[model samples]
Target: MENLNNNEYQKFADKKVPKPTYLKNVILAFLVGGAICTIAQGVTNFLESQGYNEDLCGMGTSIVMIFIGSLLTGLGVYDKIGKVGGAGAAVPITGFANSIVAPAMEFKREGFIFGVAAKMFIIAGPVLVYGIGSSIIAGLLSILFKG
Candidate 1:
């Protein structure tokens, strides 16, 4: 029996394991993200064509996107998309909905208060906090320097 050093073992394992397709994954992510954004733009355009102003169209688009994300997540379709789409599926508003819903679904057995409700925001709570905090800081700075 021979004892392999760390470097020797790593080399052995490296040869045994196949390399991942990094470029393929990047292209998939790009296509998925671009598709999501394109759909959103289409929704906005459709709304505008219906005689809605830009502001209303934008809000309508956001609402529709969020609803679609939540619906896909609830139906378990978004998980499949995420597994293949990687960051492409994750960089959109639908990804945000998936983040919130995934935890709640996973923890639902522990009761609503402690599990579903509390853990639902585990992924997104920090994002909301910092986002709001930064907006506040930016507003204050603008007021102080520009006002």
Candidate 2:
């Protein structure tokens, strides 16, 4: 009787196990991520052709991408895109915007100061800290080595 029960449980567990689609998911992520980078590159190239210097072109491209990301988030569309794109929707400047906007939108009901404003940095705060910290360290190293 115990053997039969064990066999039944094993069968149930086997049926419940999900087959992994890792390769397919990886391909989707890669394609989507590559597409995003290509779009950014196109924007940069267009700006450069319009007489913008390297700095201006880079900044302009970043602004455009961030704006698009924020707009999609505000319209409740970034989530859908993220679902389909996975990390393809992430690992870019747009992902940073989504990270900031998503939490703020989620907590908007708790009041502005306590909710949206506070939650807006849920992801961005740590990034800002690490970014600034790393820049500072790099700058100090550069100065030290400039002799």
CA lDDT of each prediction against the hidden true structure: 0.93, 0.90
As a TM-score, model 2 comes out at: 0.81
For candidate 1, write residues 1-147 as lDDT tens digits: 367588988898999998888999899999999999999999998998899998999899999998999889999999999989999998899999889988989999999999999899999898889989999999999999999
Residue pairs in collision within model 2: none
- Quote the lDDT for 45 in model 1: 89
- Candidate 1, poorest ten consecutive residues by summed lDDT: 1-10
Any runs in candidate 2 off by more than 4 Å, and if so which?
1-20
Question: With candidate 2 superimposed using the best TM-score fit, by how many Å does residue 74's alpha carbon deviate from the native?
Answer: 1.2
- The CA root-mean-square deviation of candidate 2, after full C-alpha superposition on the true structure, stands at 4.6
lDDT of 2 by residue, 28-144 (tens): 878878888899999999999999999999999999999989999999998887887788988889888999989988999999999999888988899999999999999999999
- What clash pairs does model 1 have? none
